[model samples]
Target: MERYKDIDSDSGVLGYEINNDNITVWFHGSARPYTYSYASAGSIHVEEMKKLAHLGNGLNAYINNNVKFKYVRS
Candidate 1:
C-alpha cells in the first residue's frame, strides 16, 4: 500500500492501495485494510477513490461523504 499524504493532516486515512477495480484503504489506528471494489462500492466510487488516493487528499472525506460503509471487507 502507498502511504497517504494527508496534506492537511486532517484525514483519518493513513494509506491506500489501488487496483484495477478496487481500493484498499488503511486508516489510522486500524490493523486491517478496508476494501471497496467496483462490485461493492460501484465503479464510480472506486474510480473516484483511485484519483483521491493518488492526489493524497480528500479520499477520507470522499469515503465519508459518499462511500461510507461501502467496503466489501476489511
Candidate 2:
C-alpha cells in the first residue's frame, strides 16, 4: 500500500487486500486486534501476491516472511 502521510508508524501496519470482486484494507497495532477494509492491495511482492491469491478470503494476520497468511481472496 502507498504510505499514508498521516499514519503513525509505531501505531500499526497499514495494508490492503484485493480480490476479484472487492478490495479491502485496514491496520492494527503491535498489541491490538487487526482491523480490515478501508483500501485495496496493489503492487505487492510477487510471491506474497501469489500466496494471497491462493488463500481466497479475508484474514487478520501478521506480515512475516516465514509465517504465511491464510484466507486471502484471489
Candidate 3:
C-alpha cells in the first residue's frame, strides 16, 4: 500500500493499494481496509479509482461521492 497524499489535509483516506481490477483503501482510525473491485464497484468506477489512487489525491472524496458502499469487503 502507498500512503495517500491528502494534499489538502482534508481526507479520511490514509493509504491505498491499486490492482488491475480492484482498489483497497485504508482510512484514518480504521482497523481494516475497504476493498473495491470491478465486480462490486463497476469497471468504470474502479478504473477511475485506479487513476485517482495513483495520483494520491481525491481518492477519498471520489469514493464518498461515487462508490462509498461499493466495496466488496472490509
For this target, which candidate reaches the highest TM-score against the unseen true structure? Answer: 1
Count of steric clashes across candidates, in order: 0, 7, 0
Tell me the tens digit of each residue's lDDT in model 1 across 1-74.
89999988999999999889999999999878899999999999999999998998899999999999989963
Q: Arrange candidates, best lDDT first.
A: 1, 3, 2
Q: Write the per-residue lDDT of candidate 2 for residues 6-46, one digit (tens) a residue.
A: 23234233455454433344455533322222122233433
Question: How many backbone overlaps does candidate 2 show?
Answer: 7
Q: Each prediction's Cα lDDT score? A: 0.93, 0.36, 0.90
**What are the models' TM-scores?**
0.94, 0.22, 0.91
Candidate 2: residue 48 Cα off by (Å) = 23
Name every residue pair that clashes in candidate 2. Answer: 25-37, 25-38, 56-72, 56-73, 57-71, 57-72, 57-73
Model 2 scores what on Cα lDDT? 0.36
Q: What shift in Å separates residue 26 of candidate 3 from its native position after superposition?
A: 0.4
Clashing pairs in 1: none
